[model samples]
Target: MSRILAILQKEFLQMKRDRLTLGMVFMLPLVQLLLFGYAIQTEVKHISTVVFDQSMSIESRDLLDSFSSSGYFDITGTAKGYAEITKMIDSGKAKAGIIFPPDFAEKLRKGETAPVQVLVDASDSMVSNSAIAVANSIGLLKSQKIIMQKTGVQSLPYDIRVRPWYNPDGITAYYMVPAILGIIVTMTMVMMTSMGIVREREKGTLEQLMVTPVKSYELMIGKVIPYIALGYLQITVALLVGGVVFGVPIRGSILQLYLLTLFFITASLGIGIFISNIARNQMQAFQMSFFVFLPSIMLSGFMFPREAMPSIIQYIGNIFPLTFYLTIIRGIVLKGIGFPYLIPQVMSLLVFSVIMMTLSIIKFKKKIA
Candidate 1:
């Protein structure tokens, strides 16, 4: 009991010695939250578009107005021909190009189908998809308007209404900020914890501790305690930034988030400890931590959806604790889901925590390598 407290005090003292690093740790979440919240947007808008209106008539202008008013396309410049639009897209000057045939208005007046070509830079899938969808919608709406005017129909026969829950505005931050919290926690636990142990080993302090009367598990717990505190501190800071800066609501019980966070933090810490046991120095620890970190970011559904991945890839994603933690945190923060709704995720993290901690404990020898 006293030994664990003594080790905790020692770890805290070492951490206090590096005041700059400690400060940086706290600031990590704030900076990343702001940067990622602003940068990562799934619902991409304001795509730079080039227009080539051969008709240059009122009908063509009306279609251009529809594209511009949709907020998805911004008419950056007018292209003289298909060759110019091709040059603009290839040179990265514009993402999309809208071209109206010379007989566009004539076809509309004569009740014939007008062919308007929309060229999109498919290099970026998101931008291309957005441009294509919006262009098609604009065409559909204008066609319906013209049909209504001719046929004298007041409204469409069928109405399909969509209700977007959690974030009705499709605000990227509301979805990303909470997930960023999980990321921050993972980075701190895996990178910091592993690096801290490796740093101790590099400084020969690990051998000094191992020579003491403290049990291996006790020493592990004591060393882990400080980082656990730091993990919660980071979570708190990230949640605060998510809520205050991004207006992400904590619709569920904050208590549930904190509680579920324990399993994730411990699991991450265990992974870190395992890395420390394998790595001889801090550089190795940093590199090895990425083995876990990169997978957590890519496979954990942080920036991408797991459902879209191949079946085998999705199964591989289950190995990362961050995968489960993302579900728990996003569920609690966005969906207001309680522990009952998060049993599978919580259980997965619990199992991971046990497995990783056990492996780390068994792998860590009480002697110098």
Candidate 2:
């Protein structure tokens, strides 16, 4: 007990002396929460739009009003012709273009189908999807209203309404901030711990540890305790920023959130220590950490849905500790789900941590190599 405590104190003291690492431990999460929280928006609004209305009639104006009132499209300016609309879109000044022909009003008056053109830049899938769906919905609703007025019908045969749960408004921050917390922990735990042992080895301090009485598991526990505290600190800062600045709701037990976080933190720390054991130098450790980091971000359903991915890719993602942690964090934070519902994910992370820690300890040599 005293040996483990001594190692723990030594690590903490060394960490305190390392100013740059200490600064990063405090600063990284806040910066990431602010940057990603504001930037990564799934529900795109106020898309820059251009209009070309040759009908010069109230009907044309009303159609434009429909698009504008939907709040998806923001009419920036009017285009003189198709050429100008094309130029605006091609030059990136507008994301969507609405073109109404001269006969648009006449066709509607005569009870004929009015042909209108909507051009969208589909380069960015998220922005383009919002523009396309809202534009089509506006046109559909307008047509339905016109039909109802002409026929004097009060209602349609079937009305299908959508009610979104959790985040009804589709606020991206609510969804992203919790996941960002998981990602922050993954980055620091893996990168920092992996580099720590490598740096010790590079500086020949690892030899000093070989002569000490501490066992490998004791060394591992002592090294990991400080980082566990650091992990909680990062999570607290991120949650505060997310809640105060972004209004992200915490629907479940805060105790559950903190307790479950332990499994994930230890899982990530184990992976880092495993990397440290395998790496020959700090540069190698960083490279290995980045190699794992990229896939954790990509395959862990951070930017894309695992359901939408190929079955093989989904299987690969399941191997990453971050994948399970993302589910646990988002489930507790967003859905208010608790223990029995989360048992599978929690168990998976536990198994992962145990396996990785066992491997790291086995790989760790007590003698100078």
* Candidate 1 residue lDDT tens string, 201-310: 89998778778887877887888889989989988998888888888899999998898899898889889999999999999999999988998899999979999999
State the local distance difference test value for candidate 2. 0.90
Flag regions of model 1 displaced more than 4 Å: 365-369
- Root-mean-square deviation of each candidate, in angstroms? 1.5, 1.8
Model 2 clash pairs are none
Can you write out model 2's per-residue Cα lDDT over 1-369, one digit (the tens) per residue?
888899889999999999998999888988888888888677789999999989989999998988998899999999999999999999999999999999999999999999989999999898899998998889899999988998999989998999999989888888899999889899889998889878888999877886887686787778878888888999999999999999999999999999999899989998899999889999999999999999999999998989999999999999999999999999999999987799999999999999997787667654334
Q: After superposition, how far is residue 205 of candidate 1 from its true place, in Å?
A: 1.8
